[model samples]
Target: MKEKLVVFSGAGMSAESGINTFRDSNGLWEKYDIYEIATPEAWNKNPELVTDFYNQRRKNILNVKVNQAHLEIAKMENLFEVTVITQNIDNLHERAGSSNVVHLHGNITLAKSSGPNPEKKYYPIKSWRLTKNDLCEDGYRLRPHVVWFGETVPMLMEAQNIIEQADYFLVIGTSLQVYPAAGLVHHAIKAKKKLILDPKVSEMQVPNDFLKIEMTATSGIIEALDLMR
Candidate 1:
């Protein structure tokens, strides 16, 4: 029987592929600050700056390639029922051929109007420097299709369901500092196996079922896959 493997990934998984995360290796937001770029007030006060911040993020996503860890997780899908639950905003996992994926942080490559379901939910973005001039069909401001700090993650319940249904769980690269993503460990209902991969020790507030694998996401994912076989 094929076992269900649920993978939870974060910025570190895509870092090796040249994707800059919201934070740096030292845990600082790169190029922008949380206060100016992620808050609702920021968007309300200066919509252009918020859009511009996400614009650069979109461009940055285009420059990256899927890393070894992303490929390894993709390859594992062939052997087992793999479902990836990633906190990354980039499209690396999709590009790597992983069919079952969940993006918790939102995708950098999509755009949507800021108003209440004004008409469209997904728009393929061509550039990262979005200005006030960019308009949607409803003529509303197009915001980055990201789950900002103050907004609700619409997929959290769905992701929780995925985590609860997993037979095996693998958590990679996340610093586990943020809410919701950090809280997922609380849901592995029937999960009998757990492997957490990170170079630095994680502060995961997990129950006794999880085992931390101390290593980088690249080398650690490879190592975990080898052990699975």
Candidate 2:
């Protein structure tokens, strides 16, 4: 059996592909108020605004390509059973040919029903525009399938289990600042090898045993793969 290799990725993983990180010094959060655009309160207060914000982001993401780092990570499958647990809502990991991926947040390409019903149905949208008119089969407004702030992270347990089984654990681009997601590193503490790829290492808090490759994702991934080989 191939050794299990788990990769935990964040916004930095997709940033090189032209997607913006929300927590960087010059990230999207700098321009937009988090409570106004990325919280459940915002969604309830102005659903149209929330929809518009995600629609624009989806459009931007559609225009971006899967970068080399994604490809390199997928290539790891040749030597290991690779599983990607990403905080990014983009489908770049899947697009890059990764067989298994768990999105810690929600996928941006999908929309879920806002109905009062107990069950929520997700619908795939071909266009970047998700308007208020878009409705699920239950005749309720469709909202972006993203895990906004103040909402529970439904995939946390699954991610934790994946990390705990890792023979080798890798974290790419993420600063390890976000709660719950950041806590995943603790699960992989017993892994044979652990590596973190990020240029801004000074700001991150990670295990001392983790191999810190202080560089951009692309270069860091290349060096990491070489070291693994």
Candidate 3:
């Protein structure tokens, strides 16, 4: 049987593919404040701005292709049971042919309904644009399916289970600064090996069970695969 490898990837992994990472040097997502565009309060206060922000994001995704890093991870999937848990909202992983992925913060390519009732579910939109006319059967505003701040990460529990059972755990390109997702490292038991692949790795307080590969994901994951071989 193939060993199970769970990869937790983030924006840094995708940034090399010409996509912007979170909090770019500009410190803005198209001239909008992060708070104004990425928080639940902003979505509630200004639905148009939120929708517009994601609309632009969807356009950007259309322009970029998956880089070698994403491709290599997908290639490795055939040798192992590769489960990707990504904080990135982009579809680079899917484009690279990665079959299994869990988007923890939600997907930029997907649209959801903003109904007054939380139970009102969000559905994926195949159309490129989700305009004002696009409304659920209940007439609620359609918003990006992204899990903004203040909204619960709906898949945290499932992710924890993946992390726990993994024979190998890999984190790519993320600072691990964000909560809940950042805290996932703790789920890997002491015996399981954890590897973090990033060029700009700052202080990551792991229990000495995790190893940091201070290289970009493309090169780093290759090196990791060689070592595992």
lDDT of 1 by residue, 1-229 (tens): 7889998999888878877555555543854578888877888888878887777777878877888898889999778899999898889999999999898878878888888783257787876666677778877878887888888888899999999999888888877788977899778888877878877655555557778788887878877776555
User: How much lDDT does candidate 1 score?
Assistant: 0.81
If both were scored by lDDT, which would come out higher, candidate 1 or candidate 3?
1
**Candidate 3: which pairs clash?**
none
TM-scores for all candidates? 0.92, 0.95, 0.91
lDDT (Cα, tens digit) per residue for candidate 2, span 127-201:
999987788888878888888888778899999988988989888898788887899988995688888889897
In order, what is each prediction's RMSD in angstroms? 2.0, 1.4, 2.1
Worst 10 residues of 2 by lDDT: 114-123
lDDT of 3 by residue, 1-229 (tens): 9888888898888887887776547434556678988997998798888788788788888788899989988998778888999999998999999999999988877777787653357677775577888877777777888888778888999999988898888888887778888998788763256777878765555547667788877777788665544
Candidate 3 yields a Cα-based lDDT of: 0.80
In model 2, residue pairs whose N, Cα or C atoms come closer than 3 Å (at least 3 residues apart or on different chains), thus clashing, are none
lDDT of each: 0.81, 0.87, 0.80
Candidate 3 worst ten-residue window by lDDT:
23-32
